[model samples]
Target: MTTYICDDPVDRRAGLDAATAAAARGELVVMPTDTVYGIGADAFNSAAVRALLAAKGRGPDMPVPVLVGSWNTIDGLVVSVPPVARKLIEAFWPGGLSLVVEHAPSLSWDLGDAKGTVMLRMPLHPVALDLLRAVGPMAVSSANRSGQPPALTSSDATAQLGDQVSVYLDGGTAPIGIASTVLDVTGPVPRVLRQGAVALDALREVAGEVIGAGQPDGA
Candidate 1:
């Protein structure tokens, strides 16, 4: 396992290079993100993705999200961005927000049984962006066992992932010690699957009439 401690966020070239090499070789990497530390693998690399899932004890049915450097990268993976989805991207991108959309038929990479859908996000942290930009697209999930609490720092991630991941980029603790708010934009109406740092009202401001994943019988 190769580990690099980045003294300065801006001077993470070595760590970025190591991460890039590991991803190219279809190996998992533990890296810091704005919301939390994540276990990442090349989204296009089936072997790496599978290894990541196995390491995290994640189910095959549970699709992993892809991390990108910017919103422009979304078009390459997703077929089309809904208006509301676009609004949310503009409002909360570079922050904790993950949008599920229809995957492009042109994409050959399989993150899981996504069923023609893919979850994509642009992380707000510099270290996350740097890693994403260096590695292109990576299938990332919270760095921990599937049923365990998400890792908020590199130490937490290392403790859970250990040597399973090829590289660990230590960028300190995450600003938001929670997962990104996951929203499904595949259907006509945008719905919140899980609310985290971003609130429902805030999402509604950009995506009018946003609905929760489930509702009470009476209400």
Candidate 2:
């Protein structure tokens, strides 16, 4: 496995080239995100996405999230983005917030039991965004085994995933303290699934009355 410590003025082109090349070949690439390091593979490649799940010791029951470079990328994958969702996306995207929305019927990609929904995030990290723009959407999950604590750095991820990954793009320490907050935006009202970096109070302020984590939509 090859590792690139991108902390000290690394070349953006080099990082993007290496990451996109590896991802295109159905290989795993570990890279830093706004919250934590993520293990990434082409979202549209089932084999690559399956391989990513295998390396992380993940099963097909839990769906993996996709990270995009911009709002248009999300629009392509999902059938619709509600007006409320649009407000949240406008305010918190390119930051830590993952929205679960109904996938476009025409799409054929599989990432575990995505069912009819897809989790979408647009990270604020530069390296991750560069890779996403160059490689397109990626099936990105926290770079650790399914139940393990998320990796904060490339080294931490390497220690866990090892050579199962083809490349590692190290961008020093992570800036965010927690993973992106996950919310289900597939229904009439947005509902919180997991509260993390983007806290509930902040979400409530921006989104008005969002359903709390682990509770019924109107609870």
Candidate 3:
């Protein structure tokens, strides 16, 4: 297991390189995102995804979210991006907003019992973006054990994940220090699944009339 300091350009490049290689090899890599540190694996590698869940003591029920490198990356992942979803992406992507959409049926990988849907996000962190661009989509979850606090620093991630992760890129503390707001866009109107960094009012401003999880449709 190795943890590389990413503040230095040389070290950052080395860390990203190692992370990319690790992901390609179906190994888990801990990296910092805009919200928090995440332990990531190749999204297309089922074994690696399973190992990531095992490492975190998480179950298949709470499937991992996929991180993308850029805005256009979402185009190929989902069956179709709703106009409302596009508005949300334009308003809050590369930040702390995640969207749940029906994925392409032909996708070969499994992210547990996703029910044909996938949660995707593009983090605003430079190191995370670089790694994602190199490695493609990754199945990622917060860097900590299930039911444990989220890891804010690379050291915190290492202490929790230990040897389970192959490479740890210490990209300092998370910029937002909170999770992203998750919106499910699979229905007629978008609904809020989890409220975090992005506020409901902010989302409403862009998408308009987004309902919460328990609220009836069109309420």
Return the top candidate by TM-score.
3
Q: Pick the candidate with the highest lDDT.
A: 3
Residue-wise C-alpha lDDT for candidate 2, range 115-189, written one tens digit per residue: 798899999998999899999999999999878888998888999999999989988888994899999877777
Where in model 1 is the C-alpha error above 4 Å?
Answer: 9-11, 216-219
Ranking by TM-score: 3, 2, 1
Model 3, global lDDT: 0.94
TM-score of decoy 3: 0.98
| RMSD in Å for model 2 | 1.3
Q: Which candidate, 2 or 3, has the higher lDDT? A: 3
Q: What does candidate 2 score on TM?
A: 0.96
User: How many steric overlaps does candidate 1 have?
Assistant: 1
Taken over the whole model, the C-alpha lDDT of each candidate is 0.87, 0.88, 0.94
Can you list the residue pairs that collide in candidate 1? Answer: 94-124
Instruction: Write out the backbone clash pairs for model 3.
Output: none
Q: lDDT per residue, candidate 1, 123-191, as tens digits?
A: 998877988988898899999998998998888888888999998888888889999999988877788
Stretches off by above 4 angstroms in model 3 are: none
Candidate order by lDDT, highest to lowest?
Answer: 3, 2, 1
